[model samples]
Target chain A: MPMSPEAQALLKAARKHPDRPSDEARTRMRRNVMRAVSAGAGAVGATTAGTAAAQTLFAKIAGGALVVAALGGVVVGGRALFSSSESSVDPKNAPASTSTSTTVVGTSRETSEALGSTSTAANLDPTSDRVVASSALRTTATPSASSVASSPRIATAPSKPAEANITSDAASAPAVESVDVLKEEAALLASAQSALGKGQAARALELTNEHETRFPKGALSFERRAVHAMALCALGRGTEGRREAQAIVDRAPGTPLAERVSAACP
Target chain B: MPTPNALRSVNAPSAAGGVIPVAATRGSRSTTPPKTFDDLYDDHVDLVWRALRRFGVSEPGLEDAVQEVFIVAFKKLDTFEGKSALSTWLYGIAAYVARNVRRSQRRRPETPTEDAGLHLTSASDSPEDEVGAAEALRVLHALLDELDDDKREVFVLAELEGLTAPEISTSLGVNVNTIYARLRAARAAFEQAVVRRRAKDARQLQKGGLPCR
Candidate 1:
């Protein structure tokens, strides 16, 4: 099954020379992601806002850090979780800041602009252990529904805009409702998978039940069933898990899901 | 226990190579908390971009696809309970977006353009090197296109992106044994594809078709 030398060479060369965006595109997309977050395009609530604010700041700091490192010839350290910035300028020891609430000094307007905004750096949140992006310093401070509609980039909105809880006419439309159902199904399945991965089989089963209640004939029924079977195996219900896995394998042979199911109980 | 070699090879050919220090950006998830959205984007944008391209998101639609992945990421960030590496989690999201983009593009096919392959060349690359790399990329994509979705994904994630079997399993929600099995099958299929393409090209040359170069 090993690739021939020529095929291997091609892959090695391609890997060595993978495509990437120009720095400009990277910055523009970063700004767009931030804009999307600020506009509350995905979901709405206190939790969403807090996470978005923190993310916005992280993007800013990351952008600034890259520019500084490039100019200073500082080989920024790997993804280490360092709390203090004692080695900020020293490339030899500097790790890219993943700290939620480190105070960044000498953040310039150029860096801000390069990151796709013209806003000044905001105060680091001292109260929270995580870095909280200041909402007041957001480039688009007043992110209204009207503004979200006006911007072409933001127009696409989150693929799951229904999660945003917007009760407008658009949200009530039948077509939009269908898409939201799928998105919610996916979200529930993802949470279930996360739970399974975390060894919370009972919790995973509960989420699956919630999914069944919300979406009995959901688009992701197959995926949900697979997760359910796996959870059953995890909880030591080998006979039931095997039966479920076998049903899926018989239905769809040679698929990843089939492979997963076969192995889940074996 | 194949570890996803988080970092790119140090001996990469050129500065224009634009190699991503994936490990440098994709922080170890061993003890680190779930990454902030900014951290996730900054750390793995290149990885996501490359994945989308390999996943068949055309260059024109590539940016939108990338945006969609992160927006989905933003919405689902809380669900990321640090079960898998950040890169793998993003890959899962990118895979979903890429599939959707490909599906939509299929419904509205665009006119094929001459500049179809990934634009990996940099200002630093010599014209000869640029041509070579571009052609190699073109051939690579052509071979990949022959693969079915499942095999293609396995090949792209394992061979092209350098994710380990376990990481791909976590991202894909497949069994690790299945991943290894698929990787083996994919490599063999890809080699056959290369051989078939070369044989066909040779036949064309013998029939006095244009030179490959």
Candidate 2:
């Protein structure tokens, strides 16, 4: 639709003109760029560039000429190993897209899955996987009695305050007996939080589910539930999100966890 | 593979200054001096700065963002074919960098924007006009903020910056037709925003100062 003449003029009047950087700002930026360049960080786009630049600085400071002849025999011996690895890299120069592609969507499932596969062996059973967030009845010994006390029904409060109490209550709660498991689960839950922070809702969902499977009675239940609800909302499944939010509200209405879920899933 | 005529075309005077001396001096030397990152920076710094702002980078982050864009450009300059204008290439880099910064900021939500001076004016305007113009700019930015990132980028390029559809397509990495559709939605949204602002302003004028204050 064509904007009305008056509306067009209204917006046109406010159109920002090109910005001019102050001389100080320009000088500062130039100084920064020059510093980065002189440090040889600009040689090969990011990733390995930092390592290569460090190597260059090391070569300079160590007086390589003095040691080159002495080290020649060892260098020649290792040449085959270094040469094989170096051959895989393109010599034409670093590609611009190198740094661009490294950003993960939400959770890097590979890391989470790797952590899950290797470390999860010591984890509790995946019986919690059968526990749909909707069930609200499976109080099956999730170490957090504080959480079960709040609601035997909702999958909220998988993250915070009660997290420490989860360890204190661990002596009585036989389902989750070790503080080490709680710490490991907290770290895994943090990865899901990171993924959610990156707007990776699906990845967050996976990691949240993984946390539940590994530590169904995990301490960070509040944290994981909040993240799970937010992830659902972010993925546009608002009804599911609202249900989780309702549970958080019903279970722990005053805590930050409930507040976050209420705000997001609302 | 620029002909003398084509070289002459790009060498035409620019709004910022005179022609960028990249390919124009062709016949002189095979060493027509490969374009340095600084040359790209000098020629298109203003373009990068403005585009980044439109992409929702805060004023405080703009300086670091510009340097980051160029550092990437510096490393990747070897692969830049002249198929698109240098501004287009730089805009693409600036857009990606700005979007990433905004996404990262959203993830943390703790690093707050400290640049409240975005609407403060130098005495270039008379006292009366300064308030109105600054308020208008603030309102426009607020409305721009309400737009989705993609719509905001398209709107800023096409409407405010006067970039053509094809140019925006290249800059934003969208299909040309997609650019038009987005532009249409953007214009509609912008127009509605302006109308909404007018209603608010009309109601508030009776109460005195701009609502932006």
Candidate 3:
């Protein structure tokens, strides 16, 4: 069919139909695009960043704590079980360096002095490592994790020697109410995961921070850290994300969480 | 756009891979690389958005759909060989994304273009023409909504967006002859619908209403 004049006029009008997006819309679109671009753009560098961020942030945060299962799937600060040699990798000594590669659990003499206890003094209480860890912390440190003292789940933690045994009991809690507790905490974790999956890294960060604040000694601390690292990397904070993820791997080497962290960070 | 001898050249990757590659166009006049995705967005967002609007995506979801197209294009940046005009590649993405938006949106029928939105009115247009254009577009889109998806798409692309039959074929993944056939049928259907709408508008005008349905 030949194009009618009326069709021509209408088509012209239709072709002019799209309004330029409002400045607000344009700004919003740009912000989202930039975020995605930076996120995806960073994906190439993510492995390195995730490891660096995990390693750096984890050590700085963990302080001198040896990674104990009782410390909510991560070591916060504690005595060095290692030999009397001064920390081979002291963060304090190499303050000039930006690399967190040297952040060892009790590597720095400062970390050892900061923690200042023999491994025997701060032994892991399979049932209450938080109790022991907190008892041995710097005065500036926060109280034994609120997550531990409050949640009834900790009360029943068996005096099992193995960290796995502590984790296993928490996972397979027998009481009906404890399952509800676990479910509630799991839902919070899921929300953070959902945000990350939806590409809302900022929202995911908020959720992860909230998760940490609300459940400091929660069982899914490692899981939360995983998502947190991923979100940071997705936000283009590669160095930090790598450090966080690498920390999980370093502290809990040979464990499932460490394996997952290693895979994700790499 | 003609397909290059190979799917991709190491020097000139497609848009799917990353940024737009440099094209040696305006030969000897330019040394710069080809336009980036941001450049592409600045050039074509309006075209994609308008086409999407005509293709049944409501205004509320328009921005997201637009962003999705660019995001896809950005990812597929390296895949964008100079095989087709950048616009064509973008249109292909926009159409598919808008269709997906439409598919999900069809469940709860919302007509932002019709109800609250008096879209397509221009500042230069006389108040009467502005209102008239809006009513005309409403009838146009309403009529457009009635045709089957195939006819509607062809009509929207060929008439409204003015994509050539070959471009339409490439963008829509249909044969060139099929586009011709569809465009022919679509135009006929469109003419018939316009006649019906004008007659309905006359009838409504005779009833003394200020605006035509």
The alpha-carbon deviation from the true structure for residue A205 of candidate 1, after best TM-score superposition, in angstroms, is 52
Better of 1 and 3 by DockQ: 1
Better of 2 and 3 by TM-score: 3
Tell me the docking grade of candidate 2.
incorrect
Worst 10 residues of 1 chain A by lDDT: A72-81
Off by over 4 Å in 2: A4-7, A10-16, A38-42, A45-266, B1-34, B108-134, B206-213
* Model 3, residue A105: C-alpha shift (Å): 27
Each model's DockQ? 0.12, 0.12, 0.07
Ranking by TM-score: 3, 1, 2
Cα misplacement distance, residue B102 of candidate 1 (Å): 1.3
Q: How well does model 2 score by local distance difference test? A: 0.48
Better of 2 and 3 by lDDT: 2
DockQ of 2: 0.12
Listed in order, each prediction's TM-score against the native is 0.47, 0.45, 0.48
Better of 1 and 2 by lDDT: 1
Global fold similarity of model 1 (TM-score): 0.47
List, residue by residue over A154-230, the lDDT tens digit for candidate 3: 11111122223223443233222322233334445556666776688889889889988876655445556767887
| lDDT string, candidate 1, A174-242, tens digits | 322332343345456656766776789999889888987887655345556767888899999999988
Sort by lDDT, top down from the best: 1, 2, 3
What is the per-residue lDDT of model 3 for residues B31-54, given as tens digits with 9 covering 90 to 100? 234444445565666777777777
